[model samples]
Target: MGKTTGTRRGAWAAIRRLAASDRAAGLIMLGFALIGLVAANLPLTYHLFETIAETHIGIPYTNIDLPIGHWAQDGLLTIFFLTVGLELKQELTTGSLSNPKAAAVPMLCAVGGMLAPPILFMLVIALFSRFGPGEMGSLILTTTGSSIPFGEMAHGWAVPTATDIAFSLAVLALFARGLPGSIRAFLMTLATVDDLLAIILIAVFFSSVNAWYWFIGIAVCAGVWAYLVQLKRVPWAVVAVVGVLAWVMMFEAGIHPTLAGVLVGLSTPAREIHGETTPRAERYASKLQPFSALLALPIFALFATGVHFEELTPALMLSPLVIALIVALVVGKPLGIITTAWLSTHLGGLKMAKGLRVRDMIPTACACGIGFTVSFLIASLAYTNAELSAEARFGVLVGSLISALVSGILLSWQSKRFADATTDATR
Candidate 1:
């Protein structure tokens, strides 16, 4: 038994090492996503994406045939959310979010981050609508597009507000200078809050009419999962069964099935985590890491990247969607986060982290704009209609790129500056 325990520890350690390995695949994934866009525009690749989207699956008993595109967006993606929920649970329990003081700066920053982009988006629309002849005017875009660059057509406003946790956190860890651990803790907390808000937006503003029965099923399964956790059952079979049930319930719920992943994640007990005297009930939920990292997450990325770009026009490139997304993610996210963090510290009496100065704030704020996964997920969830979804996707692509580029540049620059300053001060 002791030998078996050691082996398990060894295995867990290996997994941890893999998770820590700098072969971080998100950059590769982003590269693929860029490839997907280029492919979308290419003749052969465009056709391929369209063909992939057409694939379908369904159970023997039902008329409910779900398409491959829908399945990726709906099914495997839920596991991503589940992982998010688990991380969130950990954060709330014993991670950075354990104290109200620690929580204040991130929470306020998150709110500011969420609020700014939408306002910019809406203002753009309002300007165009007020003057641009309401779809009748020939307001040509200077950015090489046929249509005007702002409107309800640009309703992809909310796409760039998300902060993709894995990618953002990974980059945060890359600083050669001794970046404050508190910054990571702070970013994670804000991103989590941003995630929860995105979920609310997806459910309330984005989804269609609910089937009450599915809601009941989701509620029941959630209750069962909670009960099982409380009962401290750890067998793989038990978890597999409950996890399956949770998936089904989420599928039935009007809420996207991917939300089940988050629910499961949040439900996990944090007591036994990494040898912290965690409750066994909390342990079962987090044990799904291998599936999440190695299988589900990567698969979801594969499917999500399958967008077609065949009918590429300058008009499309300069559309309200493209500009709004770029502005929101690139400009608004950092601006909002940095401004709010300062205000929260000064006005709300929240203290800033010890070592980080006002200059460090800009790059950190830029990093907060890394809104890849959650941004994509929300784009999928927020728009049910094909036209709307396309618009959202366009925004998501543009915004994600802008955020990643600008934020990355800022972080790298700040990291160097921080190091030089430290050296100069010592000298």
Candidate 2:
């Protein structure tokens, strides 16, 4: 019995260590996503995979019934957003975003990043529309063998605007040897703001709130949560129950239920209280982050990335949707970030963090183009047509993959230059 217990404890310790590592978390999610994709595409496995994803499981006679895939997207993913909110709150109170002057550059760059993608998406639509159906126009056809209207296609404009913090930071951690810590800080600040903007967009554009009274329940739960977290001897069980209730209210209220996680996180006390050495928010986040990284995100990725391509034709590869996403993420993200950083420094008189320059931001800006998690969510919400949604999700996957590869190469080169410079100075 003693030996068995010891072994169980050792196994759990190993799992925790793996969960804490950003690189491990990112690789695991990628592996699961690839599994999901391959399962969706393979002739022998596709039907079973689809049935599993489409199967519904929920409490009876409540507003909670959802397919398995949606449970992954909406239910499990809320834990990830909660962690995002906690980190955002921490940054706002004590980290890089604490000072307005220092934070201006990255915040503006984030805005610029969000704005540029939609513009590029619209431009691609115009290009296809202008050159009727031979080479360019043929690429714009939907999988259903019909032309997509400009308005319908334009709905996916927000898809490429997001930046996946986990994947981007993982790439940075792996390839950014000898780079200054400020580069990581800059990426974090930019991605955090990018997440905030994406959240607002989701709330405003995607929600249909007919059951406003349910918000009263949400508000009460939040108030109780805020009160409980502030106490000297907090009851964590009660807090968890209240948090779930808030999520249920948000779902019934027709707001995206994931926002409930954000609400609870934001409400957590960021300042130390009642003889505590550390703030409650920090402690809570540290405890929950492992779960979010290891379980919540990987499950979401598995469901979100199961895109089945009907065929592997050149037209599909060069489809307007596909081309637009690739350009928006690869070219537009970095272009917007660089331009805004320059403008803020030169014209607005804002400054970057110490030991960083606008030019130094090139690789990090490229990393910002990796829009995976939120982009997938937006794609599902933006289009009701199954074909259009599939196309958009596939585009997101391809675009994020390209951004990851490009950023990795650029970061490796930059790290080499920095390392050589350090060696010469030391000699």
Task: Point to the candidate with the largest TM-score.
Answer: 2
Error of 1 at 102 (Å): 1.6
lDDT of each: 0.67, 0.87
List TM-score per model, in order.
0.85, 0.95
Instruction: Kindly state the number of residue pairs that clash in model 2.
Output: 0
Q: What C-alpha RMSD separates each model from the true structure?
A: 4.1, 2.2
lDDT of 1 at 335: 86
Candidate 2 per-residue lDDT over residues 82-179, each given as its tens digit: 99888878888887788868888999999999998888887987787666454555335654466776668888889999999899998998899789
Candidate 1, run of 10 with poorest lDDT: 138-147
lDDT of 1: 0.67
